[model samples]
Structure formats: C-alpha cells, structure tokens
Target chain A: MNWILLATIAALLIPIYEAWQDENIWQTMLAFSSIASKTSIMILIVSVLRDDWTLGVVGVIILSVGNAALMLLAHIIRRTNEL
Target chain B: MSEQLYIIPIVLLLPLTGCMLVLQVNPYHALVIRGIFGAIAALVYVLFGAADVALTEALVGTMLSITLYAVAVRSSLSLRVGAIEDQLKAHTARELLSVLRATFSKHHLRLEIVPYTNLLAMQAALRAKEIHCSYVLSEPGGSPSPPGGGSRYDIQTRVSRLYEIMQAEVPPTKAYLRYIDLANPDKSTEVPIPEAMEGKS
Candidate 1:
C-alpha cells in the first residue's frame, strides 16, 4: 500500500512534465486525461484499503466520466482550430 | 516513526510540489497544469481519509473547472480578414477598419486584416480558411464619382455558423451589405463587376 502510494505520487509528475514540454493543445489535453485517470486509480486504491464503498463509487465515477469529458472538449477544440 | 507515518509526508509533499510547478508554467499551459493540481489535491484528500472532499476535488476541481476554462478560452474569438490591396489603400477602408474595431469589440472579437494584391488571392485565402473574410471594393481605380454614385463595400465572409453572429454585430460602415451570391470560391472565377458609374454631375 505504501509503495503504491509512492508510485502514484511519482506518476503524478509525468503529466506536469509533459505539459511543460509540449505546446500542442491536443497533447496538453492528453496529459490532463492521464492525470485524471491516475488520480482516480489512487482514489480507488485508498477506498479499497479503507473499505469505504462511497469513496469507491466516487473513484469509479471519476474513472469512467472524467476522460470522456476531456476527450469531448479536445475534439471540439481541435475542430474549431481547423476552422 | 512507523513506515505508515510517511504517508502524511507523501500527501503533503506531492501536492505542494505540484502547486509550485504549476505556478512556474506559462499561462497557455495552464489548463493541463490546473488539472494536475486538482488531481494532486484529490489524492491528498484521500490520504487524509476525507473521501467526500476527494470526490469534490476530483469532479469539480479537476473536471468541471477545466472544461469551463476550455470553453472560456474558445470564446476569445478572432476573425481574419483578407483585403484587396486597392481596397485597403482607399481612405474609406481606414474608417471602415476603425468602425470594425469598435463593432467587433462589442462581441469580444479581434479582427486581423491581411492585404492581398488581387481579388483572386483574397478569395482564395477566404476559401482556404486562412482568412475568415475578404474585402472587395465597388470601384478599383481612383475614378471621380458622378452625382448620386457611391462606393459599395462588398465584404465576403466564409459562410459559417459564426457568420450570423458577425452579421448581427456589424458596425455602421459606409455602405449596407446584402448577400448577392452563395458562390463557392473554389469553383468560381466569376467576379462581381463594379457598376459602371455614368458621370451625372
């Protein structure tokens, strides 16, 4: 559990690093989705460890819904940019 | 200290580092950085056993706010205009530009004008979406106008959903515009000829 916490914490930096280095809007959105998924996974782990079903439900919602919103926004932006 | 005790440090340190890093990024990269900050904060809430706070951070902070920011950024609209070189050289064109600036500002849009040597090039730019619109003059030469004869401003914008917004927001330029054709620039080389003005004075 401790090692999982440490690894998730470490993984959090990857999106920040990618965002800083890449200037493309789509790439930035990709980084955001990555961050969202990783964070949801961390929440899920914490919920399982604590046996908190409510927290587990929240994590599931984020895991399922968050990336969809990001992808939709990215698509809209990209289409607008092409215009 | 117990190994479990170090979880507090991980929670505190990771989010703090993310916050500091976020502040260091350029504003253009802010969307992604903001999402990263929210994620880190949510993780911190989970570490503290505050599942409710974590959920709020994950949903509102991470997801909803970022989408709102994206929509806001999208609304910072800009329009590109390709002008015939002869048209831009006219005195009325400058006044038209100032009017455009005043009018477009009402809708929070910025207008950029790029001059092209010929109508064909201007039309091409508009068709390619390289420019949102093009400006053509009713008369090209420095001809003295007869009595009751005036210059017609033929501004053609790429037909889009936003065209209606632009039309509704048009400032009072010298001439009123009426759409005469739905001509596609790609297939048409037929240009609108300026009405030959008879010297009436």
Candidate 2:
C-alpha cells in the first residue's frame, strides 16, 4: 500500500468523522482530535516512506493510545490544579 | 547544476567536520579555531536563507567552544601538579631505592640519597646533582629545614626554577603548597592534610 496516499486519505476522512458528531460537544472533541490526527498522519507518512517499521508501528500507537493518554493527563492535571 | 539540492547535505556536514578537527588539536587551540570556523558556517547559513539556524549556531558554537577551552587548560594544569605529587609520594624507602636505581641506569651523573630522604632530602638531592636534577619526597609531620641547607647556592637556583614552573601551572590553591617549602605546612594547599595533623604544628 502507498502509505503517503493512505495518510492523505486518513487526514481528509478524520474531519468528516468529526463533522458527523453533534454540533456542540463533538465540535470541541473534533477540534482537539484534529491536531492529534494531523500529527499522526504526518508521522505515519514519514515512517512508511523511510521504510522504518519501528517508527511506523510507534507512530500508529502514538496516534491511538498516546493521544488518549495525553488528553486524559491534561484533564486530570487541570482539575487537580483548579482544586 | 539542477542537482544543487545536494548542497543542503554539504552544508549540514560542515559542523560535523569542524567537530572532528577541533577534537584533534591541542585543547588550548580548539576554542579560537573552532569559533572562527563556526562563524564562517553561520555566514554561509545566512547567505543560504537559514538565518534562524545561523543565529543559533553563531551564539552557541562560539560560547560553548570558548568555555570548553578554558576548562581544558585548567584540567591540564591540575594534571601537571598531580604528576609532581605522585613523584613525591614514591619517595618512601622501597620506592626511593627503585627510583635511585632507575635514575642511575638512565642518567650520566650518579644519583645519591643525602641526609634523610624527607622534604629536606629534596633540597640535598637538587644541590647534589651537578649535571642532572634530583628527586625527593618531602616527609609528612617534620618542620621544614631552611631552604639552602646542603649546597645553598646550587639548590636555591634549582628550587627557584621548580617553584616558577609550579606557580605558573598549578591553580592558586595547589600553588600555595609549593610556596611552603616545608614538609608539612598548613591546610592552605588544596591537597588535603590529615585532620589529626592539621593543628599540631
């Protein structure tokens, strides 16, 4: 598979997925995910074009689990600091 | 040359080449030489529209290389002092005999141990040598005998030279030890004396 093309397709489709969610809360979620999705797609393209299998696997993991962990950590830290 | 794009790789390799060259030179020369090369690289980067990278290289390269040079000079000077100390430490009986044997094998003048092989012993040996210098390990705890003991005129001259070399190379703290002339002076020398002996004399 052409990884650059796949990455380009993913970058385009993510916005559509965000758009399908409700206009209020989902809009905020979409805005946040958009940054993660863009970074992931860029890393994915670089990894595949460079033929770096480790980077390709790690980039996918970061795009999935790393983004979730970052968001969760940010939320917890913010709430604790507020208290 | 449509392949002018290869210039990017060449430009990136300049710092790596500079680093290798600096590593091979005497550390004292590394700072000034590296800074000059780095400045040329910065200028090249600016001409090629990498002003941001150029600015970073100019500031960091100049400051870091100069700092490294200063540290290297200080460390080399300290090492010289440490070498002298090691020679002195070997003046104990067993080592003294070994050193005397070695000296005889290599030198034209015969080596001799005069008086006692203590700090005062150094003065005697230095004076005793007509064609070569003598080595003495200053004994710990004894009061220092006067400077011109055995051959005052000859020993004084050699001691003065040794002191000059030591003063120039050693750091301030270690330099003070060379000034004492006594076997056990004070704790002023960066070389630590035992706590029990500190206030005794």
Candidate 3:
C-alpha cells in the first residue's frame, strides 16, 4: 500500500480506538481533526519533495477544504449539544 | 606588473587573518576590532582589482561575522539559566528585606512565587529584548501540571507568534520549527517493553 493510504488508515483508526477506550468526545474530535490537517500537509510535503508540483498544489487545496469542513463539523456538533 | 599577481593570494589571506585574530581573542570584545581590520583589507583588495574576492571578504568577514558574534552573545545570555536564577533569587530576597524594614507599611503584600524554569526565563528574556529566540523541549505523553498547564498554552501562543516573525525575517527555506522531546530520547524504538518471559534466565 502507498504511504498516503497507510497514513490515512492510521488516522481513521486512531479516533475509533480512542472512542472505544472511552476518551472524551471533544478530545477524540480534536485528534481526528489534527490528524486530517497534518496528513494533508504531509502529503503536500511529499509531493513537493518528489518534484510533483501539480500534486502538491492539489494536496494543498484539498487540505484547505478538508480543514474548513472539519472545523465546521466540529462547531456544528458542539452547537447541537448545547441546544 | 607581473609581480602584482601575488596580490591575489594576499587578498585571500585577509579573511584568514581576521579569522585567526578573532579566534585567538574573545569574540565579545574582539568582534568590532576584527571587523574594522577585515573591512580595510577588503577595501585594499578592491583597490587592487579583485572585486569578487573583496566583495565576499567584505560580506563574510565583516557583516556576517559581526552578526554571528552578536547572536552568540544573545544565546549565551539566554543559556546562563543558573546565573539568572541566582540573580533573581538575590533580588527577591533584597526586596523582601526592604519591605520588612519599612515602618507603617499598611498595604497587604503577597509574595508571588514565580517558578523559575528554562522556558519561563527564555520567555522573559525574549520579552525584555535580551534574546531573539529560544527553544522549548516537550515530551510525548507528558501532561502539564495545573499551573504549568496555563504556562504551556501561553508558550505555544508565543511560539506561533515567533513563527510568524521568523517567516517574515528569514527565507522560507530557513523558516522552520522543530519540537524535540528530551524525555523520550530515542525515536526508533519498535517496542516500548519486551516480553516479561524474555528477561527470565
């Protein structure tokens, strides 16, 4: 498997494991969000290192969108529980 | 003018001379002295038609050397943690003694115990314009104590501001931050612990 795929798999599983171990939901959410954001940046770094400018640009754009979505989701979840 | 060809080697020797002089003397006092000599040497070389050599020597010998020496001074000031702590403690004791000696002091005074850590000292020094930057060591899986928890948050915020400053002042390639965990010294360990039975003879 590609390193990116392996990283994504690890990122996805970490939150699940934390949740299973009865960790706080907010902490788990933060971990997941941080993982997503970091992974996107890591992919961009790898692409640039490989001299793949196109892939790097795409990775950055995707990362920006992913971060915004994650932040929005976190806010909504936080707000819904308060209501 | 074939005899003047020897001037090229002399031009190269100028920076070497500056290096040796600076190396022998303490940099704190000798930096300006070496810089002046180096600049004069570079000017002489430029007059001799060695423009490239002159330019490099002028930059590296004078400007870069002075900047590096200044940075060293600042780093030394910051890294003298033990001395700073002793000074701070002495100052505090003197202040308290003065307070005790005063008559008719009605104000309820509380002694605020400021925890003296390397991180705290660095931050104070930075704020006081004593040092430009300092590194903080963090360990993985380590939780902050109650008072330190707030201090840790403030340190992170300071670091983020420092990052912005570095990005503006330095080139993108040079503007980088690294977190080194001193507690967990080795990063290549596969297993944290070996099987219990493996240790049994």
Best candidate according to DockQ? 1
Question: lDDT tens string, model 1, A1-83?
Answer: 77777777677677767766656767877787787788788778888877888888878887887777677667656754553
Candidate 2 residue A17 C-alpha distance from true site, Å: 63
Query: Tens digits of per-residue lDDT for model 2 on B1-201?
Result: 432443444354456536544554333233333443454454345435454565455445544544555444433322111112334434233343443344332322223333333445454444454312333333333433223331101112233444454344433211123333333335213334435434553
- Give the TM-scores of the predictions, in the order they appear: 0.54, 0.27, 0.26
Please list, in the order the candidates appear, how each scores on TM-score for chain B only.
0.47, 0.34, 0.33
DockQ of 3: 0.01
Q: lDDT tens string, model 1, B22-82?
A: 5654433566667667777777777677878877887888678878776776555677777
User: Local error of candidate 3 at B151, Å?
Assistant: 30
> Against the true structure, whose lDDT is highest?
1
Ranking by lDDT: 1, 3, 2
- The 0-to-1 C-alpha lDDT of every candidate, in the order given, reads 0.66, 0.40, 0.40
Residue-by-residue lDDT tens digits, candidate 3, B1-201: 543443344345446545545553333334333443444464344434454564565456555665566555433422111112333445433443243223112221212223345666756665554443343322323322222122111112123433443334432221123222224535312112124412331
Model 2 RMSD, rounded to 1 decimal: 21.7
Interface RMSD of each: 3.0, 23.0, 26.9
Q: Give the per-residue Cα lDDT of candidate 2 at B141.
A: 36
